[model samples]
Structure formats: C-alpha cells, structure tokens
Target: MGCASYVKRDEYDATIAELRANDARHDQRLDQIQATLEKRFADYDARFAQFEGRLHVETTAHFAYGKAEVREADKPMLADFAKTLAAHHEGVLVTVEGFTDPAGSASYNKRLGQRRADAVRDFLVSQGLDADQVRTVSYGEADNRQIRPGAWGDDGLANRRVALVIDFVEAVAAR
Candidate 1:
C-alpha cells in the first residue's frame, strides 16, 4: 500500500509540472499577440497622420466685366478671392487667367487679355499675396460665352474678365 501511495504522489507531481509548462507557453503567446496588436495600431496612427497632412481643398471663382474694364464694385470680390488663394499658399497655387471677345484682332486682344490678368495679379499682390504665388495668362478672343438665340452684341465685355484657378498640391501631384 505504501509503495502504491508513493507512485500515485509522483505521478500527480509530474502532471502538475507539465500543466505549469503549458500555461507558461500560453502566456508567452498571449504577450506576443498583444505586442503585435500594439505595433499595428501605432503603424495605423502614423499613416493616418500622413493622410491628414496631405489633405487639401480647391475652389474656382469668376469675376466678370464689361467693355474690358474692371468695375469698382468688383474690388471687394477680387480681394476676397485673393484671400481665398492666400489661404491655400501651402502646397497650392493660384492662376489668374484673362479672356477676350472676338471683336478685335487676335494679337490686340491677347495683349488686352494679358493686361486684365496683370491687373488682377497686381491687385492680389497688393493685398499681401506674393507675385510668385499667382501666375497670369491670357486667352485672347478665346473661351467666349456661347449664346445662340440673341445676337452677341458685346461678347467682349464678358470675355474680358479674369478667372481664378486654385490648384492643390495633391491634385498637381496626381496629374
């Protein structure tokens, strides 16, 4: 009986030892899983930060005129538009484009169109925007407004205005 009792005690001790080893292995695996999850979360956080930094917005505003002359009332609108462009100066650019009607010679119209763009560019510069921040271009007698019904009397006036082009960094990169 004594021998049998001693053998049973020895078996019980071995079973407990094996169970403790198994538990230790399971604990180690749990710790590894936790570490992996933490690493993934950190990686995701960094990616999201990069995405937020790259995010941007773009908008276009139009200013029109008659007889190729800018209206005094349009001053405020132009200023506001300039401000909008300034807001996007970080990784963004503004294009001041001028257009003219088909009434005059293409060469003359091109020069006039350039003047219109230059005027807008100068105004924007005066309002605290950098001259380099805006680019001026002219499209003479091109990009006219289409109208089929009525006789286009002074299509030149509407064509003789400046158009704003706001481009963001991401958009430029995509192109």
Candidate 2:
C-alpha cells in the first residue's frame, strides 16, 4: 500500500508540471499577439497623422457683411470645392464652420453665422455632395479674426466666411 501511494503522488506531480508548461506556452503566445497588435496600431496612428497633416480647411466661400447669401462669383469656387470633397472624401464627414465679425449682438451674430453655414451646406449638397455627409456649425464671434482693436472692413469681410473641415473616420472594430 505504501508503494501504491507513492506512484499515485508521482502521477499527480507530473500532471501538474504539464499543466504549468501549457500555461506558460499560452502566456508567451498572448505576449507575442499583444506586441504585434501594438506595432500595427502605431503604424495606423502614423498614417492617420500624415493624412490629417495634408488636410486643410477650404475657405473660398466668403460672405458679405450681415448677409448669408452665396454670391454669384463664389458659386464656381464652391462648386469646385464640393466636387473635390465628393471625389476625395467619399464616406467622410464634413463640417461647415461659419464665422462672423463682431458687429452686432452676440445672439444675432450667432444666428447669422448659422444661416451662412446652412447656405454653404445647401450649395454643396446642390452640387452633388451627399447631404448626410455634411453638417453646419456657427462659431459666430467666437472665432472672429477681425475682433482686434484696429481691425475693420476687409478684415471683417474675411472673418465672415465659411470654412470646410473634414473629419477622419476609423473602423469601429479597431477600437
């Protein structure tokens, strides 16, 4: 009976050793997978940064003082911008940011900015851009470039413009 108990103890010890070896192997494999995933994500981040660096806001659509209408002269420029966006940024989201000079009450300027953004959005949609891909936001006097003590006239006109911004989309599974 003593010999039989010794044999059973040895068998149990061997089984535990095998399980420890298997666990170690699994841990090594998980480490390798994590390293590979980390490298891939680093590469993805670098590529995204490069793409973002190349993107610039298109600010060709300038507006007159207190007006939200798209001028006849600026229509062609807007058309070109829409075509470029539609061609290059398919499936990407676009934001039309509207700005205004500090010439009126804050609320009025905000509403005017929104109207200008909407006008630009409508024109872009009319020029073959998907409406769902476009959105509008009013910065109003918040981002007014002409708010300096000595700034006036053309500065205000420059401030009253619509800028087209592109938003990058990433795959949900990656996150």
Candidate 3:
C-alpha cells in the first residue's frame, strides 16, 4: 500500500482564514490609496465642466500671476489627470488654453499665456500624452474670460489659469 498524506480539517480552515485576512488587508490598503488620490485631486482645485457639443471635458488649474512655469505643487494632480487621459480617453484632442491676469500689455499677456499653455502641454506630454494630440491657445487677458477683470497681482490669481479641454470628435452624434 502506498503511503498517503492528508491535511487535517482544522489546518485547511486556518489556511483559508489566513488567505481571507490577507485579501481583506489588501482591499483596505487599496481603499486608503484611492481616498488619498481623490483628496489630492480636490485640493488642487481641479474642475470639470462638460459641454454639449464637441467639448467633452474641461478641467482648469490656476497658475501664478505673470508666470508661465507650471508650479511644482500641481504636478501630482496633473500626472493623475494625464494618466486618466492616457488610460481611458483616446482619439480626443487635448487643448490647453492659457489666460492671464491683465498684469501687462495685451500682446505681452498673449505671449505669456501661450508660454503658459505650452509649458502645461509639454508637461502633459512628458506624462505620456501624445504631443500631436495636445495643442495650446492663449486667451491673454480677455475681459470676457477673466474671473476678476482689472484685477491683477494678488487679487487676480484666479484669472491666471490654464484650462484643458478634451474634444471628443468621434463621440459627437450625427446632426
């Protein structure tokens, strides 16, 4: 007769219980990570507004007045945004629209705005987004688009911003 080995019933139960505990720990950790990411995204003041036409998603992030460089604090949020764009959204055009706080001449502000937009677009591209899929536009102290017109310096921070628009060409319904 060949010798046979068997696991006791208690031993089997303990093994299964251990596996369940490990799985639960993993689940809880995942939940914690998710909450952290959500909070970080919100803290950066990211807003999304969907348009009825071709504009699918609009997320705006404020920038420092008269500065074209992307802030270091904004990187994590931007990376997350870029990841979402790369993972879920495809065949969509990403437009980064730059605005100014009316701190200078209209022409100068326009160029500053374009630099801001280009900086953001470059960052997005660095985060794995396609360069061709992204474009930049400068509104540059447009009165209509300003959050607080004639408000520059500390008060005009809100007006200085870059808005990213995801244009869904294929998703548009037939006219």
Candidate 4:
C-alpha cells in the first residue's frame, strides 16, 4: 500500500511538470505574436505620416464684392494653379470655396457665393484641370472674415473671394 501511494504521487508530479512546460511554450508564442503586431503597427504609422506630409492645401484664389466672375487679373493665377494641379494628376482634389461679406440678404448671399464658386470651378476646368476633381462650396456670409465694427471697402473685399484648397490622396508604394 505504501509503494502504491508513492507511485501515485510521482505520477501527479510528472503531470504538473508537463502542464508547466506547455504553459511556458504558450506564453513564449504569445509574446512573439505581440511583438510582431507592435512592429507592424509602428511601420504603418510611419508610412502614414510620410504620406500626410506630401499632402498640401492652397488658398490662392480670391474674388471681388458682389461679383461672381473670375477677374481678368486673377485668371493668370488660376491658370498657373491649374498647371500645378495638372502636374500632380495622381488623385488630386480641388475644393473651390466662395465666401461673401455680411451685406446682402442671407439667401442672396448664398446664391452669389455658389455662383462665384461655380465660376472658379469652371475656369479651373477650362484650364485643363479635371472637372471631376474640382468641387465647389458656398460659405455665403457664414464664414465672413471682415465682421469688425465699421468694416468696409478693402476689409469687405477680403471676405468676398474664392479659396482653392488642394488635397492629395495616399500614394501607394510601387512593388
């Protein structure tokens, strides 16, 4: 009976040792997987940062008060901007935003802003830019930049203009 009890104790000890070894192996594998995931995430973050650095925004367009037409003097600037956009044909997005002063009625200002944005967009398209890449938005009087007391003339003119925002899409790495 004593010998039988001793044998049972030995078997129990062996079973516990095997379980401990298996647990150690599993923990090592889990640590390896965790390290791999961390490395992958760090690589992704670095690549995304590099891609974001290449993106750009430009507000180079402006307009006159109560006018939706692109001025003759500004046409050359728009043409140059279009040439720049053409050079970067890879997933470029141009947003033409029209803003107005707080002088006209809300509804009227909205329509005027829309017309101004449309005019700028049309000019860009005519200058060999992709129509699909160019989009228009009317800020009306909501985004007035000359809202100070007794502001007029040049101050108001500053608000009554179109802004061109240029953005680029993520560039995929070549194999």
Candidate 5:
C-alpha cells in the first residue's frame, strides 16, 4: 500500500509538470503573434502617411496667377506679388508660365507670352527672390481659356497669367 501511494504521488507530480509546460508554450506563441501584429500595423500606418502627403500637394494650393497683361502699371503689384510668392513657396522652385487669349495671331501671342513670363521673372528677381530659383516658360494660346463663342471676355484675364508649379520626386518627411 505504501509503494502504491508513492507511485500515485509521482503520477500526479508528472501531470502537473506537463500542464505547466503546455501553458508556457501557449504563452510564448501568443507573445509572438502579438509582436507580428504590431509590426504589420506599423508598416501599414507608414504606407498611408506617405500616400496622404502626395495627396495634400495635389489637391490644395494653386501655384498659378501672376498678374494682368504685364503692363508698366502692374509693376508695383508685381513686387508685392513676388513677396507673396516667396512667403508662400519659400523652399520650392517657382516657374513663370505665361499664356494668352485666342484673339491675337498665333505667332504674336507666342512672343507676347514670352515677354509676359520674362517680365514676371524680372519682377521676382527685383524683390530679392533668387534668380536661380525661378524659371520661365511660355505656352501662348496653346492652352488658352475655353469659353462660349461670344460669351468670352476679360474672363480669360486669369488665363493670361504666369503659373508657378512645385514638384516632388519622392515622399518627403514634414519638418
């Protein structure tokens, strides 16, 4: 009877030991799964952040609209506008794109557009903006305003203006 009792006690002890080992293995696997889930969520968050940054640039803020008809009278406003541009688009490159309405001859409009772009570039330089940071292009009437045949008027005034565009080759971290 004493030997039988000893054998029963040993069996009980071994059963408890086996249960403890199983519980430890289960806890370890649970920890590993939790760690993997955290890593995956972090990766997904990073990808969405990059995608949102590109969307912000594309959706908001038009870097266009210089001034009306590059006239001597527009000179003062040109300086003011340069400061505005510098303040708004400080680190980004600025391009002076000029366009014209469809009324003028194609060749004349082309030359006019070039002149308009040049005028804007000069104004920006005079206002302490770096000349190297600014570029100029002329589209003339190639990308003219679209309006109904007779309904077109000075409504196209906005179209006959220079535009500044900022670009990014890759997703940049915000400062």
Candidate 6:
C-alpha cells in the first residue's frame, strides 16, 4: 500500500504506443493466417455461403456411381480440412450433406445419399475431427439441388457428392 499518483503523460503515451505496436503485430499475424487459409480454400475450390443467420463453407467430395466411398484423391483434401478446422475453430458443427443422381428409385437414392453423407462424416472423424461435431443428411436426388439435373451415370458425377458445410458463428463474425 503506497500513495497513488496519476499516470504521467509521457508514460501513458509510451504505453499506448507499445500497445499499438502489439496490436499491429497481432493484425499482421492474423493477415498472414488469412492469406494462407484463402490459398488453401482456393486450391480445393471451397466457397462460402450465408443463410438463416449462419455461415457455411461449401466444398464437395464426389463419389462414383452407386458408391459411397470417398475417392482416394479427395481424402487428402478432407484430411487437411479436418486438421485445419479442428485445430483452429472450436464449436464448429459440420453437416456432411449428401446427394445422388436421379438414376434409381427415390427410396434407394435417398438411402444412397445417406450412405454418402455418413461416409464423409466418418472420414472426417477418422481424420481427427470429433465425431460428435459432425452430422449427416441426404438430399437424395433433389432436382433443384443437382448440378446437372436429371443426369445420371457419368454425367451425374458432379451430383454424386457430399457437400461439407460448416455452420460457425465465428466464421460469420469474422466476415
């Protein structure tokens, strides 16, 4: 317990300048991280969308016709994605939404869609993301959702994909 004194002008100025310098360094570091993340997203052709007050990172992993397995080439991208998302962002809920081409009965396609979503969800979990944080859904040959509507077989390759979606508040806030 000692006598209190007001902060001197010079001392206050110096403290503020130091704080500003620290803030600048923090900003620079954040900028660097942003640049790296942007490049990574571009490499995977990932894009962002917002709706219903949530932000989503929309990227797809395609599967072969009548198959739910994730392709070998897509695994690396998804693995890195899992590592990055789990490492940086907390409280992220990923919805592995699956789709299928219109080549089978509606019920069969729906089941196939679900299998696709589950496969991606499992893959992401295997890649290190918490299983509890990822969920699965199936659109099941929704015409409007199709990249090439009513096209099945090889032409429907784009349709046979699971679109990984992340709904995170921090992502929206940062934007």
Segments of candidate 1 deviating more than 4 angstroms = 1-69, 143-155, 169-175
Q: Alpha carbon lDDT of residue 20, candidate 3?
A: 75
Candidate 2 CA-lDDT value? 0.66
Question: How do the residues 60-107 of candidate 6 rate in per-residue lDDT, one tens digit apiece?
Answer: 589999999999988878887788778876666788899999999999
Error of 2 at 104 (Å): 0.2
User: Which of candidates 2 and 4 is the stronger one according to TM-score?
Assistant: 2
List the candidate 4 regions with Cα displacement exceeding 4 Å.
1-60, 143-154, 169-175
Give the Å shift of residue 147 in candidate 3.
1.2
Pick by TM-score: which candidate is best?
6
Off by over 4 Å in 6: 1-37, 169-175
Cα error, residue 109 of model 1, in Å, equals 0.4
Ranking by TM-score: 6, 3, 2, 4, 1, 5
Candidate 2 residue pairs that clash: none
Give the count of colliding residue pairs in each prediction. Answer: 0, 0, 0, 0, 0, 0
Give the better candidate number (1 or 3) by TM-score.
3
Candidate 2 C-alpha lDDT tens digits along 21-136: 85565445334433543343442211111132123354546788889999887787677667756764455456788878877887998999899999999999999899988889
Please give, for residues 116-174, the per-residue lDDT of candidate 4 as tens digits.
99999999999989898888998887843333433435687666777665444321221
Q: Report the Cα lDDT for candidate 6.
A: 0.79
What's model 5's TM-score? 0.45
All models: lDDT?
0.54, 0.66, 0.74, 0.63, 0.50, 0.79
Which of the predicted structures, 2 or 5, would earn the higher lDDT when compared with the native? 2
TM-score per candidate, in order? 0.52, 0.61, 0.69, 0.58, 0.45, 0.73
List per-candidate RMSD values in Å. 23.3, 15.7, 15.8, 18.4, 22.2, 9.4
Per-residue accuracy of model 1 over 77-114 as CA lDDT, tens digit each: 56655564455344445567776666557798688778
Report the Cα lDDT for residue 141, model 1.
Answer: 62
Tens-digit lDDT string for candidate 5 (1-175): 3554345888999989986785565445334433543343342211111122121111111112333345654555446545644554444345676666656677876777777778778877889677876677777767433222222135555446555443222212222
Candidate 5 Cα errors over 4 Å, as ranges: 1-69, 72-77, 84-90, 144-156, 167-175
Tens-digit lDDT string for candidate 3 (40-147): 567566654444333323345668867888988777777887776676566656789999998889999999999999999999999988898888999999999887
After superposition, candidate 2 runs with Cα above 4 Å error: 1-54, 143-155, 169-175
Identify the superior model by lDDT, candidate 2 or candidate 3: 3
Clashing pairs in 3: none
